[model samples]
Target: MDQEQIPGGPEGTGRRRFLALATGTATAAGLGSVAGCASGGDGTSGATLKGKGAGKGSTPEPGPGGFDVKAENARPGNADWRVTKAGPARAIEGFADRVSVLPGESFGLHVSTTAPRFTVSAYRMGWYGGARARLVWRSEALPGVRQPEPAVESGTRMVRTRWPRTATVDTKGWPEGCYLLRLDAQGGEGQRFVPVTVRSAAAAGRTVMVNAVATWQAYNRWGGYGSYDGPSGGYASRSLSVTFDRPYDYDDGAGLFLVYEAPLIALAERLGIPLAYATTTDVARERRLLEGAAAVLSPGHDEYWSPEQRAHVTAARDAGSNIAILGANCCFRRIRLEPSELGPDRTVVCYKSSYEQDPGFKRGHPATVDFRSAPGADPESSLLGVIYDGYPVDAPYVVTNPGHWLFEGTGVKAGDGFAHLVGVEYDKVSTGFPTPRPIEILAHSPVVCEGRPSHQDTAYYTVPSGAGVFATGTMRWVEALDATGDGRSGANHGLDARAGALTTRVTENLLRAFAAGPAGKTHPAQDNVNAVYGGS
Candidate 1:
């Protein structure tokens, strides 16, 4: 359900749109229990059910799944303010507070609930003769908890549904207009509705999907083996053979470096673009997935890579797909996954030495681009012009290329404040065919380079390939998200709009550039032969 279109836009062709987002409803139980919420019901259980709702005020009912729907504050000693419902079937029973939406503004429905298990559903309430309304969003009381309703649903019911949250709806074809939004219960609760309006399409051109799901291990390794919450500390922390398949909670201190993803995702949506997600493995295996995608985003800490994944993305770009490495240390290493018979999935398996020493590693395909001609192969560094500095922090950065096109809209004066944005610095013994060149020096500083430790970061580069390739030289994009408790506000970071706009504009221009031009055309004129075999 796409809520992006407002009535009477350029696409005069009429179509139905979809959208979803919910707020203010009863809470449900936690993941470990089956009480309060309607369960799969395998029989023997102690959980009860009740149903209650507000507005015209339905009386509290007696039976399984029943409760009073009131707005009274919690008792003096309680810190949690909540709403609850008991019912025999799963249901949506409250309004996220009625919202009056302008013609194109984004509005969220806030809901709180306690049903042990609950789902928030929003449907267009009133009737419109020839107009179509979309419920473009649906989120859960809890983030990261997977509930499949077009509306928000919570895995554990005791928590309140949050704002700035999201759910996916297919709103690709709705005529702009006003519509009612409401919640519908799935298995335990009944149905309810709220109202929302569609604003003008003044912001569609700015729409660009922000991708936070890591194709690699640095920021997203939540569920597979070797997850941070799993037995081992994962990847760089250790050289263990662990595979991670789940997501990390940004609120959890462990994700401090990867949290920038939240706002980027949020901002993209606010700008009218859908923020899509995927594991690197998915990109490698799915081509149709990226079809129609103008820009391909690798946000926050995208540190790992697979042979197939790299090849497809490069193909997409060569075919004119724009690319954004929103953070540093991108495409740093490669790993192979081995399947498991039990438990989540195979760990992000890697044994690089076998590639150098074993014929099998050389005979079979390796994931990243390898331009190495002989024995020692470190294609990643060669491809990117720098290798991992192996250090976590460094001196602040300085700008040398403030005049570049990326800095166009921002009134940034050279040498004012640059390194403030960089998170890491890296360098290598520059050499060979894959060497970075015709690069624009965005920023440079006299610091110990990663390789020499005595002198580096003295130079930082942003290369332009028919399409521009911007590199921050530092791996600190996550810091922008952390600037404020909420990722969208830039003032929280002490960065003026210019600095904030720097990130936003670069992203905007890059996506637009990709959509406007063909990929591979940027590379030096070469034969049509595939540069990397077996990918396309």
Candidate 2:
């Protein structure tokens, strides 16, 4: 039920049906910030970077927590940190002023509540035996106030709050990983989530995992407005810009992490892979964060992107870092980041197809349109290999090349099917787009989207620079990682252990190979496009 940025909608309207389906357990989780009573972890310490630019390399020396991914998860994890009771929205909710912080930095968590008081617990996401997170910090009870209602900017229809800082979170001893902060209201009135990423300053020699912050805020409707729809009762009145100054109204304010990204993070951590964390915002402004990184991993449902980020990632790929796009419909929309009341890159600006009216565009800036559209005219397929085809689909994924290294251990034969794995939204290898050469089509699945017959595809391609790029072509790929027979979790979308087994093995093969170094040199792709789509 993830809400996407609809292409042809109007000014402002209520949420589509999918946004209303965000009522189940979070399914998975990621990231955290600010801790009290924290004593150990690994990351650059004390060198707080507030709006710092382009300084990409190793972080400050580790403080109390020494830098060791294996040692950090070796500690006993606290399963009690998961939110057991998420009450009404007014019960308790909050937002971190910064999307990410270096270890030992301080950031404000602006919270609102109908309860008189609330407590906060910070959980660093990882693999600890069966426990997926560790309770690294907890704050003493703090007074709570229902902050002022969010204000909508008149011209841009942007939503933001003027809330005072409810608490100053200190990350003196936090580990550099993904974290989720739980807001527990007094007297059991309500509980909510606020997520933060303790990003790695330097991701050299590790696989850099990117959090899709832009896409998360693009779908946020806290003030009853977003890039997709607005309160004016139509998409035509949609906000031209959305600010991170307000709380997220989706998934109980945890944003999109639990369903879309957390499972992947958990699996990666479980593998004990050398991993670095950053949001798309971090990648956008930093020029060399990916330098010497063995690989870059973009998680599920990433759509909105800044041009600077694309340039950085392209540069990284050119430098031989393997690229793994773990979802479909990624890098579809072009967006610009501006500062908000709090700081830089806090505002996500996009006019969709209504780009001509954007103030930035009128000033001779790149228009905030689809990346493939005329205003910019740079199609994402040149980067992603698979082009986003359509949405609102549910079809079994049919393996077309089970012999590929990605499916090495799966033992599936060609024509094997995983029910409902290609869903909601999908991508396909299209010759019509600006496609890279020697791309291999791995899976081909038929679907009828909005009554239009078409096929979805999974693809992998290798460039001469020895960089290998793999795309999943399905948004449900991450969510299916945790699928069980009962289909109890909202993330699974009814996919069973069959789908889980397939994705897990393939992903394991994918990541381990990519992490070893330039994947094209180690496991170069074999082109098979002609065999899959003859004469097309």
Q: When superposed on Cα atoms, how far off is each prediction in RMSD?
A: 16.3, 9.1
Q: What is the RMSD, in Å, between candidate 2 and the native fold over all Cα?
A: 9.1
lDDT of 2 by residue, 124-190 (tens): 8877765888776665566667777778889999987877666666566567889898889999998
TM-scores for every candidate against the unseen true structure: 0.50, 0.89
lDDT of each: 0.35, 0.80
Q: Which runs in model 1 stand beyond 4 Å of their true positions?
A: 1-239, 243-258, 270-279, 288-293, 338-347, 351-378, 381-387, 425-433, 449-466, 481-498, 518-536
Q: Highest lDDT: give the candidate number.
A: 2
